[model samples]
Target chain A: MSGRSRSRQSSSVRISDEQITDLVHKLQQLLPEIRNRHSDKVSAAKVLQETCNYIRSLHREVDDLSERLSELLATSDTAQAAIIRSLLTQ
Target chain B: MANSKSAITLLNSTSSRLCFARTSATFASAPPDQLKRQSRRIKMAAYSSMARVAGRRRAWARALLFRLHTRPRHKTLMRRKRRPSTSSDDMVGKLRRLLPGGETMDVCTLLEETANYIHCLSTQVKVMKAISNHHLSKVN
Candidate 1:
């Protein structure tokens, strides 16, 4: 029974390893920063680091845009506010 | 409703901390649980969007702010740590620096978290883009 369970565990680990490789491939494709680099040499960790940096920049961009939107809405007249409110709800 | 309220809260928070570092030593670290919660928040956001409900898209925004707020306190602690080992181990160390709460994770868990993080980030970008496009069209 123990031997059988061990084999099963090993197979599960192998499956997960394959899944990780697939995920790494997907991540590599999504990141334009890493796309120009030699695929054979770039490591998964490097891809992850690039991805983290990309996400951080995107987060910052979103924050900036949201603040600007709020400012525009705040300064605009009621009609503009009504339009945006409608747009958001739709 | 709750979604717009969270967006307002996100706007009300510290304006911007847009530092982009590629290989900086002063990377921030977070507990693994928080990372999991961030992923959960993203899932909630996705579910709401799919259901055509006004969802709290600001969860990731708040998380980003939280990371920036917490960055300074962990710098020295992060730099001081050492784990000397194989080449793959060095790669793991780099990943630990990259992912939030990655410092304590095993390789499997790290990969899982990375997947979730990537998905959340893409969703965030999409949501933000949609919002921006909506507003820009209205103003123009």
Candidate 2:
């Protein structure tokens, strides 16, 4: 398209969901661009490590509750069944 | 919505303080139940607030990440995401896509930085999910 024609057609360039999806697909098209950062492995690893630590510390209380629930049930099928029933009703 | 990022950032910093206090209180307190309850609140508040911020972040991140990938080498072929529909995510994403190419930093640089930021936000969301589950379990 010539500059004049492109200018005339400017308003026609509308972005939509398909465009977003296409943009996402095209962006993935350049994931190989990530190859350039292989040399920065150390910093990337640090980022990854920090992210992992944050994730690891996220649900300690939840884990505790799950653990305590398990202990309370103590391998008793009846206790487990009751808990499941109560949860489902709620 | 204009203050969403700032609100979340403020929340983030405060939550960190609460989390830190919880840690110290855990060691200082002799009682287990009280310590556990306070610690649980810290986790819940941090997770829920961050998750809200992150939900917005993902919207902006997806658009910014896409713009970062496409470089707009051919003006005619440029594929933009929508009008962002909300505030912070859209603002951040707009700033991202508007950065001039063949200028100082390359598209790859900006995209990577934004991607890393988005990745960090997602990690926070996961943590929030875990905390919420924990809180719910306790209520039961």
Candidate 3:
């Protein structure tokens, strides 16, 4: 009975060591994937930020164009009214 | 016979009058200066529409980034906690108690769990890549 229990204990230690070795190997395999994922996320975020900046610039340009259009329309309307009034008086 | 001829003449005169009225109406509605201004207004409208579309795409990209940022982080790998050293037997005993199985079974379960974690990470990365592509296409 003493010999049998001693053999079982040693077997258990071997099994545990094998399990630990397998876990370490799996972890090592995952390291590259983790690093790649981190880099991808960083690059994606940078692109997204640049897109936002470009959109903001486009919005500003649209606003400026609309303002200028409004000013041009108002001046044209006044000039047309003046021309019609002068023709009427003549 | 005279009444029919007069009716035909009246019809011809009215057609000519209608044509003149149409031309005069067009001229009054769109003079040279007004036509130029109208074209400019149309061009501005097109640009504004393009800007609105760009703004919408930006919002979508921003939301995607927000979701990615809010995802549950890998806490175990991200933050390593220091622990006091223990004997190999004690550590194995603790693992056995936590795992509630023999060595082979414990190893299988741990491998399965790590595989699932990696799978989840891969899916998240795919989603981020897709979002990035979408943003790039919209920008172009």
**Local distance difference test values of all predictions, in order:** 0.47, 0.39, 0.35
Tell me the spans in candidate 3 whose CA falls farther than 4 Å from its real position. Answer: A1-15, A33-90, B1-108
Please tell me which predicted candidate would have the highest lDDT against the true structure: 1
Error of 3 at B87 (Å): 15
Q: What lDDT would candidate 3 get against the real structure? A: 0.35
Q: Which stretches of candidate 1 lie over 4 Å from their true place?
A: A1-20, A35-41, A77-90, B1-101
User: Candidate 2 chain A vs. true chain A: TM-score?
Assistant: 0.30
After TM-score superposition, the amount by which residue B102's alpha carbon in candidate 2 deviates from its true location, in angstroms, is: 16
DockQ, model 3, C-alpha based? 0.03
**TM-scores of all predicted structures:** 0.46, 0.25, 0.24
lDDT tens readout by residue for model 2, A50-69: 33233233334334532443
Candidate 3 collision pairs: none
Query: Candidate 1, residues B6-107: lDDT per residue as tens digits?
Result: 443332221111101101112234345443333333333332232222212323233334453455642421133555645644655766665555665556
Worst 10 residues of 1 chain B by lDDT: B14-23
DockQ class, candidate 3: incorrect
Share of true Cα-Cα contacts across chains kept by each model: 0.13, 0.00, 0.02
Candidate 2, residue B92: the lDDT equals 30
Please give the ranking of all candidate structures by lDDT, highest first, separated by commas: 1, 2, 3
Candidate whose TM-score is highest: 1
lDDT tens digits, residue span B48-127, model 3 = 22223222223222222333345353331111253554753343333322221223334434343333333333332332
